[model samples]
Target: MITLWLFILIGAVIAFFWFGRQIAEAAQQHAVGQAEKLNVQLLSVACVKRRLAVLSNGRLGIKSQFAFEFSSDQQSAYTGTMHLENLRLKKMDIPPHRMG
Candidate 1:
């Protein structure tokens, strides 16, 4: 029973790590796409929030929020936020920024 419990814990950890990577990749892609669409330069992206949340389908799912920095001109930077659910982009917030 102890060994079985250990296996289960390890499996859970593995799943969390695997899904985290996928979420990060999806977040980066979304950030990049948004930046390109806005004709800005993407600087950096980082995971901001992660939790189990109710999705649009009314089911519990892994939700991740990413914060990204972008620059329209080389001298100034702006912040953007993106939310992803189960490796899919759910929403994004980009503030008004100056254009080069």
Candidate 2:
């Protein structure tokens, strides 16, 4: 029984990281698309935060928030956020940045 429980725990840990990686990839794609649409350069996209919350659209999901750095003029750096819901982009909150 102890060995069986250990296997279950290990499986859960693996699944957790697997899902997290998938979510991070989706968030990165969303962030890149958003930055391109805004005519900014995506410097970096990192999965820096995560939470379980009900979205404003009234959907209960795992919210994976990625913090991204962007540059419009290739000089000034700016920060933005991309929110993902189970590997789907739920919302994007990017403040106005410089435009080149």
Candidate 3:
């Protein structure tokens, strides 16, 4: 019975480590995914001369500054500046020429 208890304790420790590692890996993957999503969304907005700056405003937010250049002699629409957080929680529309 003593040996069995020891075995169970060791098993619990192993399980804890395994679970912790999985959680850590998941968090890392989530951050990477968010960054990629933000990049895609930024590109989709017809953004030219785009710049991204990260700021810690209690939450991680991306500050974007860009202009939409026009080729048809039309006035270019400049977004001027924008901030985005919780990228996965939002749907974004980006112009096709900028996305590719």
Q: Pick the candidate with the highest lDDT.
A: 1
Candidate 3 local lDDT, 9-96, one digit each (tens): 9997796566544434443344345436544321122222222344555553333332322221223221222223322212223333
lDDT of 1: 0.91
Candidate RMSDs in Å, in order, are 0.9, 2.3, 13.9
Candidate 2 ranges with C-alpha deviation above 4 Å: 51-61
Model 3 weakest lDDT span, ten residues long: 42-51
Candidate 3: global Cα-lDDT? 0.37
- Rank candidates, TM-score, best first: 1, 2, 3
The alpha-carbon root-mean-square deviation between model 1 and the true structure, to one decimal in Å, is: 0.9
How far is 79's C-alpha from truth in model 3 (Å)? 25
Q: What is the lDDT of candidate 2?
A: 0.82
Model 3 clash count equals 2
Quick one: how many clashes does candidate 1 have?
0
lDDT (C-alpha, whole model) for all candidates: 0.91, 0.82, 0.37
Selected candidate, larger lDDT, 1 vs 3? 1
lDDT of each residue in 1-100, candidate 1, tens digit only: 9999999999998998898998898888888889889999999999998997899889988988899999999999999899888888988988999989
Descending-lDDT candidate ranking: 1, 2, 3
